[model samples]
Target: MAERDEQSGAAPGALPRRAIALLRRLARRLRPRSVRARATLGASAVVALALGVASFGLLGLLENNLTRNAQADAERQAVLTAGLAAEGRLDTVLTPDRGIDFLQVVDAHGRVLAASPNLRGRPALSAARPSEPGTVRGTWNGRPVREEHRQRVVQVTVATGSGLVTVYAGTSLREADAADEFIRASLIFAVPLLVLTVALVTWRVTGWALRPVEAIRAEVAEISDRDLHRRVPVPGSQDEIARLAATMNTTLDRLEASVIRQRQFIADASHELRSPITVLRTQLEVAQAHPDPDLWGELVNGALEDTVRLQDLASDLLLLARLDTAQTPPSAAVDLTEVVREVARARKGDRVAVDTEIAPGVTVRGSALWLARIVTNLLDNAQRHADRSVLLALRVDEAHGTAVLEVRDDGPGIPPADRERVFERFTRLDDARSRDQGGSGLGLAIARDIATHLGGSLTVQDSERGAHLVARLPLDAT
Candidate 1:
């Protein structure tokens, strides 16, 4: 019971502390959150700001007008008073109908002679602060006179005996002060209301702006590895964010395609792997059952041959994978004429006819390995079909600015219908003259990929010359 009481008293847990802190921050942001609050705050703030600037301007203007009016009144009255004091018309100047006050007269001795109404011969002019007539503030009658922000006017002139004469006048400013107070009150009241209105409006506008993003995020969240075909929603306009969403959807589409291709490739690889393993196993079983040494040797050779095919297929697969990220690293300024000569020199027996026309200094930019594969695949394909001889030709197409490699076999060529069909993996021509050389059939496809990757082309051209396979490579500046 003591332990439970202690846990509950005078101490807080970390979670409670954090929660309290969060709630405090939230409380600091508390307000009337609604459309009306936002509108009111926004409109009121704009009006208040405009009115504040206008109030300062107007107050200054009104004060200036008051000062100018007072100064003009003092100047006119000073002229009239000066003329009257010169004639010693003191009684007429102090007439009850006149609105002036605190009048005095002075002689050359600096002594007040006849003062009027509230003054009994007091000095009206101060020698210390003398100027042309202007508005000011001071005290009178033992009361706090000349309230702050109120206006007063003073006038002075020379009376008889060359001594100066002075007059003092003032009025209550209750009406003007009250008006200024009302303006301040209105501005103070409106400003906070306007601010609250603006915050509410901003929150609503932000929500509208983020709607498309929220939709895109929700759609993207639903996508899984199994359902990558789904795409993020695109907004109406081609804004930067919209384009970004579209790009993400495009990337999603490409990823989906890649996933599909990878699945198919896996299936294809499994089937290809199964064939060789089956052949090797069958050959080994036959060798084990029949104990004849010659038969065992033949069976072992068959198994070894199947193993070699498997190795070649696996190597090709690995090479293709590498090629995805591989630059043609072993590039050289290779002359196609020299390449043809080397291939022809390395060729065996009368399986192919050697025909060549080497352009003098034609060079191509490509890796030798890929370039060699391009040539070997065409020559081997030609050699397989050609009964009499295959013709090898090399030349430069000056018009096209391309280095051309041509291998023409006199055997039956690809028909116009099937010319595009032979490059696919494991594709065999349906034609009778086509040879079955136990090829994996990925050679042409790989060759085409390499050629294109090297900024060149591999093609079967319509040659009036013979059954044609031509490869064209670019001659970039060395």
Candidate 2:
């Protein structure tokens, strides 16, 4: 079971799995879905978090500073009272300062010696009895005091003639507390408003940033097969958005070219098919009208010829379609030498004397059937034009990493100007449309397309008297 679990990639440890799952769910819930939402929320979240931290830190610093200042003031007053007692004017402490809320002097026995105006003759402000004379202050020092009508007080002790005296001082905390409360309330009110303002600003900015993309999307969506010539708007900024628009236009250009070629192919195929159909129909109609027994065999043979032509034309069309849309890489190892020899053997015993000089080990990577078709097409093309002899050659150019094949014939060679044009579909040299030529005219075109699809090339080369065609394919290095 452990091995199976491991093989299936299950988690290996007992852990806080439920907690982890819950956290993942919460994370997913908090995540914004759209680009615009994510941008706005991310910006707002960062700003809100910063404001919260800064507000907390600033409020804490202010409170600490205010409390320390109040404590320092009380200690200063206590020291001043001790100085007055040393000069025999300790009673002067009864008149407290303006900010002072309370002041009192008590003896070692906890008896009041001097008191502020409002606390005259009151009991000792502190509940703890004072330490004995010459006692070191520790826990024995006066404890914190709280009066019924005032906040807590700070006290200090001083040595006097009456043994040891304690001075108690306190000030109202209302002003400091009020300032803190005001700051807290202000932050509480302003933070949400700031966050809302940030969210609004971020949302608007994100929309503005995506406006060009939206325009491009709308333009692209409007485009279809009917109007592939139209292009998306390109921004003038020369930024990434502009690059995207340019790339999209480039893609549209390719799509338009493909559509045009497809339309031309369909038109050409339809026209070619109609010719045989019309001829077959005419021949059958004439035979039916005449009803002659002797000419029936001739009419049937003619119909069979037309049917064969139609079959060949349809097969060529299907092959072209497959070539256009084929995505599989050609990895079959093919020997060009063998393919050429095979074509030569098949085309022997004809009027054209076929010769071969096939070198050994001229190997390439491609479909064997297509490779054989290429050789067969070339031989057939040569046979049609050759007056006496055709030469077939296959050799390996190891230095160039290529396998080369050539077909040459002693016939009225293709003119330099019409060499490239002959490879077009349905093209023929005989402008008179002679049936004696006997070809669908897609042989060389299909051969060239197959060579190109196999990462190779087929081209017409300059010949002195006969047409020379050369096909080159990348040699299989392995």
TM-score per candidate, chains pooled: 0.65, 0.70
lDDT of 2 at 424: 88
Residue-by-residue lDDT tens digits, candidate 1, 1-478:
3233255463436557878999998976775475454555566677667767876887777656655554455445545555677676665235322434334444444565555555564563444333333334442322322245453444454545454454444333444566667767876776556656665666677567667888998988889999998888888877876998999999998889878866866676777778889989998888878888879778888888998989988976776666656565456777666766777777766556656555667788877676777777777778776767777777777788788787888777778777776765555675432323636666776777777787878888895534688788887576
lDDT of 2 by residue, 202-318 (tens): 999889878889999999999989999999999987889899999999999999999998898889889889999999999999899989999999999999999999998898899
| Candidate 1: segments with Cα more than 4 A from true spot | 1-145, 148-184, 189-191, 237-242, 326-341, 348-350, 364-366, 385-412, 415-421, 431-438, 463-472
Name the candidate that leads on TM-score: 2
Go through the candidates in order and give each one's C-alpha lDDT.
Answer: 0.66, 0.81
Clashing pairs for model 2 are none
Query: Which residue window of length 10 is worst by lDDT in model 2?
Result: 134-143
